[model samples]
Target: MNARTADKLATGMFWAGALTVIALLLFLIGYILYHGAKVIDWHFLTSPPTNIAAGGGIGPQIFNSFYLLVLSMLITVPIGLLAGIYMAEYAKNGPLVKIIRTCIETLASLPSIVVGLFGLIIFVNMTGWGYSILAGAFALSVINLPFIVRVTEESITGVQKEYKEGSLALGATKWQTIVKVLLPTAFPGLITGFVISAGRIFGEAAALLYTAGMSSPNLNFSRWLPTYPTSPFNPFRPGETLAVHIWKVNSESLIPDVRAVADGSAAVLIIVVLLFNILARWIGRRMQKRMG
Candidate 1:
């Protein structure tokens, strides 16, 4: 066969694969949205679920999901960034560096279920935290840490060496150069990694199932203190996130509309994740322009 013929065949195959992927994605998304449209309304979103009610909402579970995301990210981002800075900046090629990288890779490769079990053992049992929000957040942080560290290290190291040199030449300290120039330039990438991590956190059920309990008490938004069962600030409380709620409803619910509830919750979760990704991308682009 002629080279031109082979090239055309390869090109056709690539386009065919791309189109197939797009079609599958559209079909899956459409199917979910259509099934969920009748059940997802403001009332469904803002009201708490009822065990006997035909049309129950997922308010508390939704709250728990966002709470988990925030709590986990709060713990993950700073620690990850610091480790990344060390890896990219100060850590020289040596035994310690090798060990650190090895550990990070091992952690990254670990299954989320393993991390969840670890959290269950340490954060839940060892610390007497039980199946609580904090335990779940810790589990998520473990699952997320390696990715954040890798992203941060890459973003920092990817900054052109010349930028650092120029900053140093212009009388900036190494620290100053990293904080002012490198970090700003890397902000977009860091945001991307963080948001993608958040998206994963939102969809996680297995990890949370083993960490955060499948039920939460009626949270009193009025009681903002840590000791109150209803207090949002009480990390020690067990809470069911949206993903876990969906799994629970599908697997164990006796409610007649359990399927509808699960579908609606799943759709909401998917939409939120999608919106988050889109928003992250937009923010990253804006930040990139600003940095430029």
Candidate 2:
């Protein structure tokens, strides 16, 4: 084919592929929302699930999901960011750096089931935490830490050198330049990383299966103290997240409304993940505009 014809064909092919992907995503989301919308109500969302009866809600599961997410993020964010910053700015390109990168890549490529087993061994068994929210959060950290670290490092390093030069020229120290200039400029990518991590944390079931347990206790939201056994904020309490609940309902739940419960929980999980993405993007844009 002539050059112009070849270029036109490639462009058409690219457009076709992009449209196919968009169509598939829309169809999947629409299918889930359509089915799940029928059963999602305040009662379903706020009441504890029934063992063998119908009309069970996933109240404790929802609470556990969010609580575990917050806990994992709280643990993951600072450690990941600091490690990424150190890797991007302070680490020398040497043997140690090479080994560290290798390890990170290895961790990122590990299977979720393997991570779950590891968590079962260390966080649950060795630590004697015994299938609790804290154990689950630590497990999620293992799953999410590599992604966040890699993303943060790449985002910061991807910033234009001009910003760093300008900051340094303006009498800013190295740390100040990075903190004030590079991170803000890289906010969008950082936010993307966070959203991706949040989605993974929300949807993860394998790692949490052994760590978080498969049953949530009767949570007492009125209990304000974290030390309380039934308190929502108690990290030591066994918490079955929405993802795990869905899995259990689909696989082995004897409840009569198993299908409805699973569908509703899946829908809520998807909605929450979408909200996290949208809110993170909005916050990132606002921060970037202010920094700019």
Candidate 2 residue-wise lDDT, 1-292, digit = tens: 9999999999999999999999999998999888999888888888898632564898889889989999999999999999999999999989999999998999899998899999999999999989999999999998899999999999999999999999999999999998899998998889878877997898899999989999877887899799999999999989999999888989996778778888898899889888887887787777778767
In the range 198-219, model 1's lDDT, one tens digit per residue, is: 9999999888988998999888
Quote the lDDT for 86 in model 1.
92
TM-score of 2: 0.94
Which regions of candidate 2 fall more than 4 Å away from where they truly are?
51-55
| Model 1: lowest-lDDT 10 consecutive positions | 47-56
Error of 1 at 42 (Å): 1.1
lDDT of 1: 0.91
